[model samples]
Target: MNFRIFKYLIPGMAVILMTGACSGNGANGVNGNAASGSSGPNSQAPAGKEVKISFWHIYNTGPMKELYDKLIDEFEEAHPNIKVDHAGYGIFDLGDKLATALAGGTGPDLAMDGIDGGQLKIKAGTIVNLQPYIERDGVDTNQYFPLLIDIMKQEGNGDLYRLPLETDVRVLFYNKEAFREVGLDPEKPPTTWEELESYSDKLTKWNDKTKLLDRIGFAPNLGNFWYWTLAWTNGVDFFDDQGNPTLDTPENIEAAEWWVKMQNKYGTKAFSAFQSQSGSLGFDPFVGGKVAMEVSTNNLVSEIKANQPDLEYGIAPIPIKKNNATWSAGFSLEIVNNKDQAKADAAWELLKFLTSTEIQKRHHIAGNALVGNRLAATDPEFMKDPDWKTVTDQMQFTRFLETPIEAQGWGGQMWKNVQAAVAGSMTPEQAIKTSQKETEDLIANYKKTS
Candidate 1:
């Protein structure tokens, strides 16, 4: 793992853990704490007891759900004494559902959640620490990216609370046909902000008859690219050591300015009109041939394949600024804090199986997504795909974002400010400063009420 990458992973951990203090489930929660401290590799239930543990994950549809269903069947067949019952929830609802269950003194033996959500569970003292098991079994932690391991640990304590299942990185995707049509080299995508701007100018197509943009080369606001991503690439920390919003930092302001500049260059009225039409276009602008390049997740490749298999496109590292940086976030598997030692042990067995290199590789082959296991990511079969390889190569510079529990809805606010700036109602500095002040106020208000 690169040092630069690790630097971004845990910066918000301590601050995140400090804000969300949830109550433990029940008397069972005490047993959960004790198990983390005492459990060893050899700990087990009586030979004939037969442990049954339930797992709830967020993969209710598509290939991931199918893969999980298939893997669960295999797991049960191999360990007849252990019965694993699993269920899936919609992605947006699982975290809230898990929180509700824990508050009501019950939860699945195991569940899947994002690092930010998992940290809240850790702060509540209702997540199992896997460190003891790892130490006793001599599991090589190096098999995971540093951020995956880092995000799983308890703040100010070395206890690990979760194991990652899937991870993703942002990258630049461009249409090769568009590059050739513009007389630019399709093989050489932009590697810097200056080059991105230069290429966008060359690739953009204007319609004089309608005075509209027939083809947009690139737009800062397009795709999955966020304002925070640009800020991170330019070495801007969204929060300070004390967890205060630093949205108005010079680098952040510069990033905002650039975004607004692009909107202006494309003609704000025309840009806004085009965006409105594109949103209702029923397909990705890049896939629909309305945009030439986009910054998006690795999963976008599958989207392209599904919607426009004949399209020629290429993936590259997102253009860099002061640092080579990309943002990532993933789902992790965690054992719920409970009284049943046998149940916890069973959950651990399932965890190991799910994150194993073989399972991770199979999942990728089935769904075209990245998994937490480094060995699986580097498998010869997966490495052969140029797009997959391009994405995996970015793992070295990838960083995860941690949102403070108190600032749950801040993203919606920040994005509104972004729209205001890009629409020219606010200057870049004003937009960022206003967002900073509003977010700070949000945190301050929560602190006062708590």
Candidate 2:
């Protein structure tokens, strides 16, 4: 199996590849005969017969794990015929374990994971096509955010293999205290690239004698900042309509050059040294007051509340250039390919129950995550919080980059070129050109072998 393809199957911009081989567990420990039925809201299993479906997820700890278990219990109570054998796996271990299990025909009936890995499973023929079930059950795809649905259909001839579960959108997080200290208006955040640069300069502090950075205003690579987001903000798309690499476009080059310039301004070595110091001390640069502003996702709000509840902070859309766009990514629920039709039907029932508005709202509140379900996302109860409202408001402008399967390995390769440009080993134009050629070569080679 090509693990490179699975490595990019992460939930968001951060990619972690699990290379260790995992051993399979048989039938997820089923204890009873599986029962088949229509997957409608009113569907019920016959008396004296029960179906057991195994479910695997990465929410292994904290409130999310507890909430998941509680939901499973509720689901079982509502449909006594369906019993779910829920299991938790480390996020890093899921890809390899799932791949191994599916290959051995011992995988779970249903799984929730990032779209990237789900795509690899689809390509490997290890996941079921959910279109038939969706149509038969009259599942309304309209209930979900359109972008989430679009990403799920990007694989296998536009077939819907997974249902989006939750998602996060990137935004700007600023320390209001830092802005006040810098003599800038605490209520207003930078709205444009030029304004952001000016604010960053004013907010940054340095020691004249030691030549060390005292505080950083913003770092392009900090938190969840992705070069793709920056490029998109500058009116660039990394791929063309035909799914070809378009990294060498003028707008992309400009974005890369701008990032490198920001790094050079603070001295890359010094900036990295400061970042290392923060990491080594177990401190978040932003939360610890080492950095005044950062580009981060909705999750940062929870982190801030947990780490420094009293910190005066503000959330705003990421400073933009050509458009009010931000990058978005999230997880989806998929039913693994199974030989037993009964187990497949049971899994579909569970999938619908989990994605239903009430259940989704409960999950979002318990986890403080942005759910993909429109009703849950727009619920006034959850949107009452200012921070969440600010994050959710940008959904209309959020964009999801659908990477072509043939170019699955492009992310890591492109990051290397980005590093080269940041280190001054190559110009931004040269870096992008090199990355484009290498990606095109990779796609061509993959096609020949596939």
Candidate 3:
């Protein structure tokens, strides 16, 4: 694969200065000690010196936090020479904190970050190029989903800088009870966009006196809803192979128009008022039976179990148009560029241990996450959960939104423009055209500095 470099911006943040450490092993190699002369489960760290690497992640509470602790303890026991100093941060704060720390030369040796943040770090030179380390250790990139691996590569040149740990897939989830209540077959969920709209119309309820929505059949912009995913199902992508914005495509415009029609059908004022009621009451529209169907990620299953255990729900691959497609996002583990050869090697060892099939399997079970490692994700034992199985089965048809190197903060921008269109403030075509120009200017500015 050709690795290409594209420019993009990190929304709500500024480009900070980043520094790369010189490697003793030359441009294409990482600075690290030779591998331990053992194989399989008995791999050992180079004999004498003990190296400690700091690890930071946003999984700070509950089951996920416990799982991280267990994994770190086991890894430390196995590689006695390496000690991990682990810290947890809230997801919202971690990105800014890491940026500030890296800028001041006090960043952790390794971190678990979202793909977008990892990309920003890669561009900033705050993270180490992991290709050399992968080569030196004979790491098998083939063990991962090709699409997952592809996302980690630098835009212009395929230098891998992050290793994905876990990921999630988007699917359409329906309240089976709601379906039955509407006289629709609970077993047969909507398979096409037209069916989705028809079923939604039947399921939706209105208070004749108040003229407000009592229940919504579906909302295009609800949980895990991504416009790009809709476009993808119609064979449209936001960026071309060369990383230029392609939001103005006919398919994309159609997708945008579809959402606007949904808004108009429900009446934007009534829809917004209904959403406000849910928010005020701390109610989940889907779980509270206010929404018949929702486009959501797998985590919604666990959430439903926790908040409304008796709610019967069914998941299906998202409704398709001309093509079958879904969107996915995940967190990746990355080694930071700290100018320390020994620590970099230590971090590499830890990365391998964490991403190993067995460890990945255990982690997935403990934290209830979709494993990024292909073997663990496909393992029969892990795939036993019907909900999880539904998600994993869609992996082949799932793709990440194309965030060009230049459109780093495109997600927020796209959301804003789409919302404007849905609210009738801008036509679908105008919204997309505005997005394309804004994205182009963002790229241009990024190029000027870069």
Candidate 4:
């Protein structure tokens, strides 16, 4: 599993308030729980024979772990004869262990991992194609975001390989109090790059005598925001139509330069020193009123609520440069190919219950997350919340990053290059050019083997 998945999947502290609300029918118009007699191949445990399936996942702690345990207890009660042997591990450890187990033909029947890792397993033939089971159960794939479900389909054969668990979009989080303090209207936030720069200037504070920044109005590389997000906003794709890396294109170079400019305005050394202090402060700078604005996902709500519930803030669409765009990414659940037909069926049942409309709604409300199931997100009960409305409304401009398989580990390398540019070790053009060459070489090596 990716480290990013760990951040997104952990439920907020608010979830503890909704622990009683997990049971409900699926969005597909069927009961999501096996105890409700939902029609499916594994809806009921095999007659006169007990069946067991193993489930492993990265949600090892926090409210999410507790929520899953509660759901599992209900599942076992509903299907008296079917047993689930489930365990949790550190995300990286889980990925390593899962790979080793699959190689040894002893992997669990069901597991959860980052979408890319799941895709790799699918290509390797260790993960099961879920299309047949989806068809058998009449699951309404239409209920999911088209982009999300589309990505799950195999490139050539269109076989669905994994199911998305949660989806999220980036948003601009501004401290309303900071806005008031800076003489900017609390209701008006920056909508374009120009405005963001101007607003940030006013919102930033400096310790005049020390010639150091007291606070940053906006930090381009901070929080969950990624450099690729700016590339997309500027209408540049990481790759060309030929599936080759295009990181150093004119458009991308411009975007990287803009990001570098923002860092330079604060003086790299002074900014780096301030950032180190902020980290030692042991809380999100936004929640601590140290940053006037931040680009982050809805999950930041959890941090605010947990640390300083009284902080007033506003959420808005990300400021645009060349286009109105943001990226969505999330963790997904996958079923491993099991030789025992009964175990396979049982794994599907567990998956169905987790994604059902009722459970998905609970997930959204409890965790402040955007679920893959559109029905769950748009429910009348959840739609009433303004924060949910803000995030979901931006879904129209949201898109998934479509990295080609040949460039599987490209992001880590790209991040290092981007960091070098931000820290002033290299020029933006130099960093992007170096990344472009490295990524192209990666694709070439993959082609030689594949």
Candidate 5:
């Protein structure tokens, strides 16, 4: 789980709260007993057969873990015949494990994919398609977030292979104090890129004698591909269906160029020491109060509140370009495709239970994670917070990373060069040409083999 749980909130954020996560065999779920079918209105377990299913997931820490454990209990309770055994795994490394397991014919019945997963992008090809199961169960996909259901369905008339468990979206956050100091209305976050640049210029602060940065205009490189966001906002596609690298498109270049300009025009030699001896990414200057505005995600909310409760932040839709498009990402519950129909059927039931509307609502109300199911996002209590609503609303403008398979084989090598150019080593023209050619060659080889 990429989630971090805090039991306690920052003063008013929660009346009684806890910060650490549940570990060991600890789960703060409902009653200790295993629930049987017909015990509740949502039961899906058939009358017979005690099936065992293994699940490997990423959320073992924080409040999200608590929420996940509870959902597991709920699933097991509803299907008294199936016992779900879950193992915790790291987000970054799970991909390798999953690939090995699937290829070797020994993978968990349920597994969580890496951070970039959307419904249609299950490239590892281990998950069972859920179309037949959903139809048989008469599941009303409309009862959940509509696109989540749509995205989880395969692009070309196939079954739903993944169920969205949760989602996080990026938003524009500006510091009210910084806005006040610069004679701008703190309530009005800039609504466009042109306004953002003009406003950012005004927000930059400097010292006379030292000529050091007192505060920055806006933080760039929050250790994320926020550049992708800028590229996205400016309308850059990583590739088209024909597998051509489009990052060199005029809009993408415009976006990346603006970022380069921001770095040169804004502060002094920043501590390029972000990559330290320990190999940890640089400290987040955003949290340290050096940044006045940023494109950020809900994933950082806990840390921000912990460090600076009175930081006076306002969230807005990310500023737009030709039109609006926000990059959204999150975790999903996927069932491994198996030749053993009995085991897969057992596991699919578990996934459906965990991602059901009732359980998803519990996750949202837990105050730790947001529900990815569309129906849960509309829960009246869920949207009470205007900020969360902003994050969820971006779902309206979401873009899934629809990278092609041939590109997938060498995307890392390509992105390494991507990082190089974005870091100023190579020109965008060079980066795109090299990466695109590599992908084309990879696809050609794949075709030759076929």
Candidate 6:
């Protein structure tokens, strides 16, 4: 795979200054780190004083939960005067609380949200820019995985308003025993979409006499809201430069329709036949000897092994259209800008400590997700893992954010529109056109208010 570097955000000279201050002549500090975390408006906390900052995050019990508490304890111990009051919840609840609290000026001083919402928050002016704090005393870009540096920027002001905390990538997980039974090679997972569909056939089997599907080739959810990845791969987009929604583009319609045809052949009824009983977390159509291949998140690897230790599976980037890519989704750390500069600065210190290489590596070991910072992501310890290394390395080619569109809940709406198309209730052509028009209308409504 070609590791191409896309220039989106330019690292400021300020990173050099922060590296010097934090990493310092102590010679062992993050001075070698290059994020420049203190570059934006109100990025730093007050100097040499105890500042209590409240933080809310979507990280709860798991490896992440443990590591997070440990990191905070260590940070508190290190700073002495800075105490972080932390409140943790599930991802969904975090977003809800942030929306409610920020609106009322009663939110935590620091908060972590899914990166997908970061764009929305920054656009709505719910976040504070971190460039000022990092300009002279921030994290350096060189110390981080370079991709992460630009991942935190906002398009309008080119401000670094958020920091990359943890990230995830998609991988193809397949069943090994199923491959053997079908007389196919289990070692080589399909690399191309065509190969995946063809390999899937080899693993699919049915009881001809009974007219029952004995096994399926693949799961039914691949096409769910993956249009962003497909759109990028095909060099098409569902929005214009003005951020207007354009789901009805010819290329988008083509990508959506192609997948719909595949679902139709598989029999929509067959895919959902067991939906009521099976529900969403269908770990394996393969493990149950029903399907052969699956493309799931890196975070699911741990659960997969725990449930089916003996099941054979391989990890690789999800199949693509033109270039190698998949959806990039993860959680991030940001200051909610409570209008108190001291609290915001203390929050920055907390963000710095949480995203530090030491803490990031600890989080990765827990198997919750990859650290959003650069150095830890590319660290030998990360890339060396047989199962997870490939997934982490693939981020070099990953898209940090999807092309922005409009409306508050437009993404979910678009997802449903596309889901209906895949579930066979609508045609791909119908789905895109309907989604595009609805999205345009939503954008128009929001623009008038602003």
How close to the true structure is residue 392 of candidate 1, measured as C-alpha lDDT?
91
lDDT at position 2, candidate 3: 31
Better of 1 and 5 by lDDT: 1
Model 4 worst lDDT run, 10 consecutive residues: 1-10
- Model 4, runs deviating above 4 Å: 1-48
Per-residue error for 367 in candidate 4, Å, reads 1.8
Predicted model with the maximum lDDT: 1
Give each model's clash number. 0, 2, 14, 1, 16, 33
TM-scores of the candidates are: 0.87, 0.88, 0.87, 0.87, 0.78, 0.81
lDDT tens digits by residue: candidate 5, 68-98: 7877887778788888898776664565566
Question: In candidate 5, what residue range of length 10 has the lowest lDDT sum?
Answer: 15-24
5 or 6, greater by lDDT = 6
lDDT tens readout by residue for model 4, 1-450? 111111112222112211211222112211122222334344443545688899998667877788878889998887777789999888667756776676666778887755433444443455566766787778898887776776666431466767877878899999999899989999999999889999999999999898887889998877777877778788887766666677889988998898888767888777888888788768888888888999998889888988899999999988988898887777677776645557767788788888888898877766777888888988888788887788888888886655555665566667788789888789999988998898888778877897
For model 3 the local lDDT of residue 83 reads: 93
- Candidate 2: clashing residue pairs, number: 2
lDDT of 2: 0.75
